[model samples]
Target: MKAKLRQLFRAVPDTWKTSATIRSLLFIVLGLLIYLPIMSDVLPKTFDLNVNTVSGVTLTAPVTVEDTEATEQARAKAVRDMRPVYARNDAVTVHQLKLVNFVFKKVTDLQGQTETTPDAKLKDLKESSPFALPGDTMPALLAMPAASLTAAAQETNKVVTAVMQKGIDQNVAREEIQQQVNQQLVLADLDSRTRKIVREIAIASIVPNVTIDEEATNALKETVRRSVKPTMIYKGEVLVEKGQYISEQVYHRLDAAGLLERNASYLPFFGLAMCAGFFVLFLAFYLSQAHRDVYWDNSKILLLSSIICLTIIVMKITSMGKGINFFLPGYAVPIALGSMLIAILLDTQLAVICSVLFAFISGIVFNYESLLPVDFRYVLYGFVTGVAGAYSLGKATKRTRILQAGFLVAIINVLTIVALYLLLSSSTGWRDVLNQSVFGILSGMLAAILAIGFLPLFEGIFGILSPMRLIELSNPNQPLMRRLLMETPGTYHHSMMVANLSEAACEAVGADGLLARVGAYYHDVGKMKRPHFFVENQINRDNPHDTLAPGLSKRIIIAHVEDGVKMLKEYNIPKQIIDFAQQHHGTTLLKFFYHKASQLSETPVSEEEYRYPGPKAQTRETAIVGICDSAEAAVRSLASPTPERIEQLVRRIIADRLEDGQFNECDLTMQELERVTKSICETLQGFFHNRIEYPDDKQVAVKQA
Candidate 1:
């Protein structure tokens, strides 16, 4: 039965197994699995209660969690315990004393006015005193003799000054102050008339000298808030005891704690899955429309999917274990590291797309425990920093460029963290701000370090021709490249010229110029095996083909492609470079050997035997390199090549390839071929330009002993 199952699974076709759509489907299913568990509490919950409700079943905490309501209540109590703030108004007491002196002077002047009637003088004194008193009290003030009135005024001023010095506050009412004044007046040694007048003056002089200070009060409340620690409900604690009534408040607490029966809704799970699907579908659409090459290739799809999954897995791991997140938040997951790797290994545009998609994924994955399930602050931080990493490492051809990009990404991450952190909470402490900023910077550097570590693995396993890999292959110190130079020095020089021509042409046609250049460097690696078999390495000025039969010469010439393929496979070179070695000659016939054999043989020769086994050039870069290889050899054999001759040679080479249908498999257009011809001709002209002749004595001479 196990064998049958193994056979059944193996029966699937290789094409289906390597399908990008299947990989995307698997990725979507994995995303749904990751989201479902975290989304349990996010699902909608409805309680079965009108006003009062009884518990249908007992509830218990599934995990240790904080009771938010109770914590808020405790904080509120802490704030309430704080005392109200008050500030003493020294100016109030001084101003009230000054008013008392002014009023007593006015009263004394009225008592001594000789020309005015007592009734008129009493009216004037009442209005000038600025004190609230009965009309009868003002009239009675005239009955006291000047000597008694002066004593009363003096006593009232003394008592008012003393009372005002004690700091009367707004909390004490006017009636209470008046009662205290009346008691003090009764204790004074005076008759009823003088005591009553003094009591009235003393009461009016009293005013509030202390008032509520709003800023100080708010500052105290803030201090209390900051001191209140988080309150939590322990794991497995009793949420509701047996036979306990489920009131509205109790039901809400259970619901908020994710323990209520109504919290089991699956709608949110479905919605979250759909949201994830939307992002995946959007990425698929983007790849299909914008980068058809990446979308169609299964290896690239697998790599992309693997990178996204790896990044998210890392994010999930770093964000695990609740309390530890204070040092490293969800935004510190190093998403930009993945983006930089993708940009270096793949396309920059694809890296940007991955950045946006991962941002959304990060927001959802990290916000599981938050009240709001999607925290867009993390999304913004991840997207901006990831894009910065990708864009900063635009054409990363060296390993150290990744480090440079990491520092740039860290700066952007820190900036984004500061902006979002301040926006979310203006009152955040400098210590917390500094902590999050450190995490942001560390996230960027960690991402770069991880990318550097994992880059070789992806390149080797996938056989990707990244810019760095191409640069490495182009180095003259490489084993194969060095062997080619030592064994076939003439072919090595020819390859360099071809590389220069191909690189210029490919750039003009908007193809992979680096790929073309590197491919040209290794195109003739097979010549290293039998260096003297080809004409270029024949240093003795003797043609080996002259001594051999035409059939043998043709066979020797045609065998280089096969030998090169074997050497490339043995050395584990990427297929992209090997394509140039195999397809550089295409299926074109060796005309010289074929005609020579037909002239010597009794029977006509078959063209198929002299032709190269080829799949043709399968890309624009490969096609251009093949054309340049033939053009450079032909141009070098010219008697006196000038601008016109070089142009004609290049045009003829391209025209021959077009006539022979060598470019049929690739997507090289007629217009692009014209552009390549122009660029190659201009470069060749400059490479073979004339040099100035110097006088024999003026030029530095070397003796060849």
Candidate 2:
């Protein structure tokens, strides 16, 4: 059943492939999926209650909106509360002081006039004064002695100068200025009449030296108004409880938010669509430029899209919960699950990119208040945990590694949660911290569990040869591996040696070393079908191939490729591994059989008949594997092999394959081939290094004597 399904997927038509039309449609569907969850928060929920009427149900804000009435009231209060600014005029103080001096100087001049009567002097004093004085007070100023009058004038100047310097504006009333003058006069040494006269003169002289600065006062009020933030009806915040009366303020907020009317604005939806479109375009651009292999393969693209959609859906579901106690349910969203799976089943670099995308999506999905376009707390948590998950699962070869990756993610999640709480929250308590930590741990563990459960399904459905699957196939206990080990131990040993050589060479040339190693492990599985015919497994037995005719031997030798391919297919192995078994020989001639047939037969033996069916190495991995397979066998056959001989033999094998057009299909460069040659030679030297020969006991005794 699985085999048939695999065949069906392989035979899918070009219409279903990643053409422009299909790609666009897939991206459109992904964008819609993203937009739908976001739209749920913005879509208005209307109420029927009027102001002063009781609400039937508790009404929570669907989206965050400004409470305009409350905001305006707050602004008005801020303006009222602000104190008016004032500016002082030095010229006003200077002129007022001059008038006070003139009044005192005139009083002195009247006292010194001998030609004038007391009435005349009083009249002169009154006429000369800058400000009005009482008729009774003027008579005392006219009769006063020069020294006493001079003290009064000096004291009046002191009082007026002190009061004027303190900046009296229009806000300061006449009575307040009189009270202030009286307080200063308490310390003056003037007689009652003289004090009264000085007080009247000083009060009149002290005009408002400070006036309101209209520009400065207006600017201060503006600053205060701007500082007062608008009152917001936060999303999910209760506007009115069930059976609660709807106040005028509440009604106005509801109406302003479009929750009291049917005609809601579609701008939120349009904005969300734009955001989703941007995310889709970014993903498309990234895949096209950085991971073209996944971009071109429609199946891989589908797999990636499915993972992203599933992860977002999980986050959305988790975010909908009202949180356990003080714990944020967003902490338990398992955001790292998608990244870990992508890292294991796809490219690690692509997984890192998806981690960032998931982080941003999580920010939007988990924004409970909808106050900000994205809640940065969730963004930070998602990014740190996702990156930790991806990096922790680096080249994972064991199923348990996923769990380990999850554990690491959990640790990071806990730290991230604690850090965010400490850094972003104003009043986080111990209970809240503990609850978030627990949820964070649960998120990591859940991500691991989900990734583990989904891995096999993805590999089977999409025929993805993940590192874990490759390692599983490489295990000695696997059925095919066991059969090779027991039935043809010699071939199994040769396969292991080739695996080591190929893995090193492939890695040296920046190819998939794990894939190459796993491929080499199963490359010679067909030899188990005719163990004795192969010289390696013919221990203590006759070489069956030596007894058969050249044509028959050629058929047996060539049959392994077909037989290995058939066995691998029956076992439902991935096509990549199967390619290794099929393409390792790459139509290379069986020289011994072809030469034998040429020498014995009257008719010339055709080279094509002796060669394996040709579909030469079609990838760098296959090409490197084939080269190492030949080099390992050839080097093992050499007697007393040296480093120089090994290097010479490895270079010759690569040169022959290059000249014979075996590597023509693959994109292996001359520089890379040289690296492969060096790597193989180095690996073979390690395998066949000279060892110390210890002397026997009798020889050692003879030498000692």
Candidate 3:
């Protein structure tokens, strides 16, 4: 049972290839699990409170929340309570004055009629005027002297004009306008009967000149409403005590804060599901667009999913400590750990993307006591710290550099916390600020430590070739490298030269230089099994192939590639290094042995028998390493090696490999190949360049010193 469990754990990731649909569904489900805990508050819960019942349990605000419904209701009431705005219609006042003047002009024109009798003139004045007057009032106006009648008309016009100029709007009542008119006539010189007639004229002419301005009134009310901030229920604030009755206000507050399960709405959960779906789709789109190679590889996908799931689980566990949450911030969780590990194992660009995704996940999972489920403070803290770790480790080629990256992450974490505190927080108490800053710094350091601890496990389980792993393998003190040096010194030197050439060329062509150099170091490990059989290690000038048949020699030569693969697997070496061991020869023929065999055989010799068994180079780095291996070997054999001769040899070897289709599987562009040739030539030329020589006696004296 133990063995079966171990085997199942080892092979499960590989077995996912059985169904693509299942694999995609599994990824989606993993996303849901990672996000579900953060969204649990949104799901429905049961509230066991009756309308007038005593509270069974004390309820407090889980998070700071705004009473949006109540706030909006208050704003609406404020708008309704506001006085309506009004605008003056000067045109209506002007027309009213014109009608009053028209009545006075008709009275004057009727009085000027010489043939008309006093009674007829009075009746004519009434008929001509658009305004109506009392019969007794018109008769009195005609009976009075002309000067007195003119004075009364002038007084009436003055009173009416003054009322119109006061600017009456809809807000001004008709009685107010009439009161002002009556007051003005009380002090007039006109008789009581004449004053009564003028008062009636003035009242009729004064229309309500004030009109309601709906747009202006609404705009003013909206401005006031927006100015009023919503009243918030703060986190940790008391809602209901142990024995307190559950009032309507308390029930509503609980419902708004998402504490009442009976009032719980699934709308928020649906929104959460949609958000999770969006994250999944966005990740897929980003991977397909930016990293097609990783997108297509199921193993990389599995590895990525595992890291995200593990990180989120850790965050959830840390956030679950409600007691600790009072002292330690949710933002203090070590969210940068995943990014640091990923940056070391994968590309920095992918690590940067992982930083953003992890930050978003952190905000959701650590949202306790926050106003919103997505806490921007935690998001900022996570993103800055994660990216800092990745950027710090981007160019680091040693294991100890991980420690330096951790310090960098910690410093950045503290700065981010400080900045967010100043920006997002309303209170700036020194104690809270200093405490948060300390937690942030500790969080960053913890991330670095966690990353360091988890790195080896991830590398081993996933078979990942991290930079640190490559560096470890490249050390000469390793068992394999040391054994090669002790048993086959010449081959070791040759491998070192090949490493230098391949590394330079890979860098020139924008490939993984470290991987190429490390791969070159291990490429010829197969030759160590038969050290004396190969020419380089045969230091005594004795040729082992001379007595043996050409077929036998060829068989011995071909056995090394397979032997190396077995040896590497036995030592549990990563597949990346094993690829170099397997593909360095790349099906090239052993021409010296094959030609010798052709001369001795009676039947025609087949080219297949002399060639090394190969699957060919599967990547640009592997292909370049193979080309460099051949170039270095061929150049070493030149009796009079010069810059021109070395260049020709390197170019010829690459051309032959190209013609033989050894690089066909790999995507090596023509431009990149030319750059590789140039880089290798330059390195070889310098290595073989002229060096000053001294006498043997002088050399012995220097060696003694």
Best by lDDT: 2
Whole-model alpha-carbon lDDT for candidate 2: 0.86
**Each prediction's whole-model lDDT (CA):** 0.78, 0.86, 0.80
Candidate 2: count the clashes.
0
lDDT of 1 by residue, 1-705 (tens): 433433443355658546867767755764664465445434533435322666665665544456777778888999888878988777887787788677666767777778999879987877776778777777776667778877877788778766766667777988888877776676688987788778876887788887888999999998888788776654335667656787766766676666655555556677877776777778778878998887777667767766777777777777664346475657578888779878988889889988987787677666543445566887898899889988998788898888888898888888998898689676577788788889889888888899888787777766678898899989999988888988899999989999999999999988999999999998888888877888778877688889999988888888888898889867778878888999988888788998998999898789988888897888998898888888888888888889999999889888888999998999999999999999999998998776787657535454322
Number of the top TM-score candidate = 2
Ranking of all predicted structures according to lDDT, beginning with the best and ending with the worst: 2, 3, 1
lDDT of 1 at 262: 54
Task: Flag the better candidate by TM-score, 1 or 3.
Answer: 3
* Candidate 1 Cα misplacement greater than 4 A, ranges: 1-255, 259-263, 692-705
| Candidate 3 C-alpha error for residue 471, in Å | 0.8
TM-score, per-candidate, Cα-based: 0.68, 0.75, 0.73
Candidate 3 residues lying further than 4 Å off, grouped into runs, are: 1-23, 41-60, 66-232, 236-253, 368-370, 692-705
Better of 2 and 3 by TM-score: 2
With a 3 Å backbone cut-off (N, CA, C), the pairs that clash in candidate 1 are none
Cα lDDT tens digits, model 2, 74-145, are 999989988898899888999988998887788888777888898888877777788876667778777778
Give the range where candidate 3 is weakest over 10 consecutive residues by summed lDDT.
1-10
